[model samples]
Target chain A: MTDEAFEQALINLTETMYRVCYAQLRQKADREDAVQEALKKAWEKRRLLRDESALKPWLVRILINECHNIQRKNRRVIPTEDVMPPPPPEDADGVMHDLILALPEKYRMPVLMIFMEGMNGTEVARALRIPPGTVHSRVHKARQILKSQWEEAQKE
Target chain B: MKQFPDDLSRAFGRADKEFVYQVQCTVKKLSEEKRKERTMNKKIPFGVVLFLAILLLAMGTAIALTIHNWKHIETAMDIAVENGAYWEWSLNAKIRLIEAMAEDGLAVSEGDMAALKGDDLTEDEKQELADRILTEQYGEEHFIYYYTIAVAEWGEPQTWTLEQRYWFFKTEREKGLYLDNSWIDLLPEETDLTRDEVVRIAREAVRSAYGMTDEEIESYAPNVSFFITDVCDTPRWMVEFYTQGEDGQIHGSPYSVLLTRDGEVTEDWENLGVLTPAQARLRQERQKETAVDVFTMRGQMRLQDQNTVFWNPEGGKHYHFLADCPMVNADKLPLKELPVWDAQFGLLTPCPCCVSLQDFWSLKDKLRYDVGSWKYPGPDWISEEEAVEKARAALEEEGCSPEGLYPAVYSTGALEEEDRYIVYFDALLTDPDGFTGVDPIYYAIVDACSGEVVSCGESESNG
Candidate 1:
């Protein structure tokens, strides 16, 4: 696809793509920065896309990569105390959001695509360049881990 | 008036909408900018391939420069060296011969295949084998996997007396631990902790769970393969201790250790792969990310909401990213709506013994929680998060808080799900009551997703 055509395709889905970026980055500013960087990268490598329809996944991949880059470079500072705090109440959705955000990169991308973005395991695999079965297993494992943690919180 | 959490959910939705809009605007600007940049790079297809070719050439040159490593071997190996040119030709010929013979459903004997080596196989015979290899072996995941096993040797210098053998094997099925130090560490069987430690942990866990005495534990421990290795670098000790469960099926509990050597443990104590709650919260990130990819070929076969356009491999276009390609919607579906055919996932055929993909995907809560879990293990590698946590705790116990620390989780849960979790932050360690508001933690879940605060607070002003 031509660079202009690719840009146009991405632009058409700009809103949705933005939502995905926002969901990932959390911070509006970071999301904007990530999406912007992703767009530029995608546009510059338009020919690499091969087909116009592949734009979404390609761009999503780029966007996620950009978020990683941003986090890596910024190096957020977390405070550490030796004391053990009381456990928080169970809030499935809230905890899910936090835990999803806490996941490692490999699981996060595939998990996001499968659950939040509402893509199937197959589509997630394609976008991540992983096999469908791996995606399925990862999702299953991710869910299992989440369930275990959730159960842990409830017990506490 | 009782208000529901849905109201907060709406606010979150608004935030999401605004965030999305903000990103779109930035994306538009960046795309325009990249358009200008692309004019310079000039859109080359297989550009990476070209770059890789150049890289390989450089590597080859480097190898060629190092002649001493090629110095020792047998005269037969020397003959192989003298016949380097011939062998190269022969290897190519063999590849062609194999490719051709793949067509037929016949496995030629070594003698016959060797006889055909100097170019004796008819084109038809070659084609048949090639077809057969492609159809039978190449089609199977294991074949492609096993085919990857290879031994490679750099080409010997022309002055060398013996051929320096370099074997390159590629296979689809991998046998060894898929950890980074795989080059240094041998298989699990070869590891130092493979037998004793693994057995100890496994036996301890089993004995505690089953209320077995030391004698019984010792007997079971030797029978089981209990040992731990630096397979994933996590403090993970693979507890392969097993015995006949209540169901009569031989079952094993492979516990992943999240605790430190100094920490006390009881069978009732929770194991989240960490010594403390803070460490667990911090280390869980690594556990999530280092998750191994056991089954190859990840892609969704179902569409979300059934619109299908958002995630169809047969859609307008397909990207190389596995997740971006075709996907089957596994959630929010009726049992009957599940796709009957999936090229990749279809391998998970239903068994009379258990649930099928259809059954699993269609069940209540979108998973067969009632059925037995897949007894397989998790990823073999440790997350950097866990490593960092271990490093930090070592620092803290040693009073190295000034070093400041970062935390990570192993895997991220799927998006859109309501997963609940609680991370413990100790007041004794750092009084939240004394601190300001939420602690500014530089945290992240997955490399793919950003991190958000679960909870951070100072205690209510020392009432």
Candidate 2:
């Protein structure tokens, strides 16, 4: 891709990247740093991206890896905030979204990629680097958990 | 659950606009930073324009005393190197260019060229020998003029390798996650066009296509190389101009064009880098013109299902055949068995990133990713220590001592973009008796997982 196209493509995905970074990282500063680092890597290694069709998942995969590196670095630090950036809302969709975010990261990312990010089983598998079947199983498990949570939210 | 996806998309879409803008800023900043870093020493630009003017200035010895003065061009190039117009390593690149130009003019055999590839002689000795060899073949006066033009052109390191030029096009055509790799090479028929005309056409194409100001051209150090592929009856001039990054790879989008002997650009020029208004209009014209990069909708990209080759569980715009999928097997990411043609596969819109080349022919072939895989195992690659140990053991196994050699460049699996840890070692050479420079002695590519040395090379210290 031309640097113009490459830059524009990355810009267009900023929202998705921000969401992915926010999903994985607790602090905004960490998210900012991770986002920049991932973009830098993607730019430096832009030639490596053989297929442009895979840019979204390919980039998300990079961001997730960056998040992993940050997590690895901050493994010992105690978290001051939970996964949900804000308190749960009253609406069913809002409540359900928070519940998804609250899911264990292994399960949470796949669910978000599939439902929120519109990534499919293979895409989630590629982005998360889990087996395709593994991605299915995790999404399956997360769905069951969300179904139960949705039912309970309806009751409330 | 029915409205869950829509709701989530809506909910997640509420992320801070500042966050999105900040990330955009980050991407822009990073691009600028990389471009700046690459051109850090390139403070003064205008190498090409100045040389072109100089060529015009040197009309003849009768009119201009400096017609014999190749010294001015040589002086200019020396000044460029000193001014950091070229990278430090470009000194090596400069000599390589001169040697290549000289070789082309001399028709040196393959055996001689292979011998010259080895770094057996000092820089000065190599320069002197190159001068002597070319001077003898093409008399002294002609040689000075020839060398002058070479020094001027050498400002932008000309890539002479046929493979390198073709690979530049091939790589651009095959963006890892973009289009299917279907390409047909249709060369414009050979002509009696002179080399000078080819270079001029290519330079103009690059300048116009990128909307590059003279300074931008100089800042980028647009390296243009022309090679007429004579393999077929239609031996056309392939002109490629690209900026070489620190990694010695194309840092910027390379623009190339195939010119008919008459100098008109074929459809080939339109698929490359940021296009100017004129080039964009050409894409508009390609509706009638049979251009190569027209990404026609073929089929849906699918994820693998049990028996169904690809049931379209997810939407992928591009498809790759499962054969030769070494990385996929290793990655455990099953290849989506795609249909020869299927409706289940979601709509294959013009994939945003697939803009370079939308070749659908190689859809049935395994997708090869060079850097990191789509899996992006860069951060999770084997640790540095493990990579070092692997390289160390391989070096010892090869009967090469690791003493005095330091691992200056250590890269793990995903960084290789392949599944190997690339460890390059360099030893500092002391010239108490003669000369000094760091010579890379030994290098190893170790498998990231198995710790096996995939390959290893050792260079005996020639000092």
DockQ, all models: 0.07, 0.11
**All candidates: TM-score:** 0.29, 0.34
lDDT string, candidate 1, B216-277, tens digits: 66643223211122222223222323334233333222322222222223332233211333
Query: Candidate 1: where is the Cα deviation over 4 Å?
Result: A2-5, A15-26, A76-96, A102-105, A120-122, A146-156, B1-18, B30-463
Error of 2 at A59 (Å): 0.3
Sorted into a CAPRI-style docking class, model 2 comes out as incorrect
Q: Report residue B381 deviation for candidate 1 (angstroms).
A: 49
lDDT of each residue in B1-463, candidate 2, tens digit only: 2443334654444546567767778777767755642222222135533543454334322232312333333332343333322112233544454455554453555554544566776655554455444445444311133223433333223543332333323322332222222221221223556655666777777678767776755544333333322112233465554455444433323355566556777764323222343443333223212211111111122222212342223534333333222212234345456453342322222221122221211211112312111223245566656777788888888888877565633333232245555565655444554212345667787666677778776743312
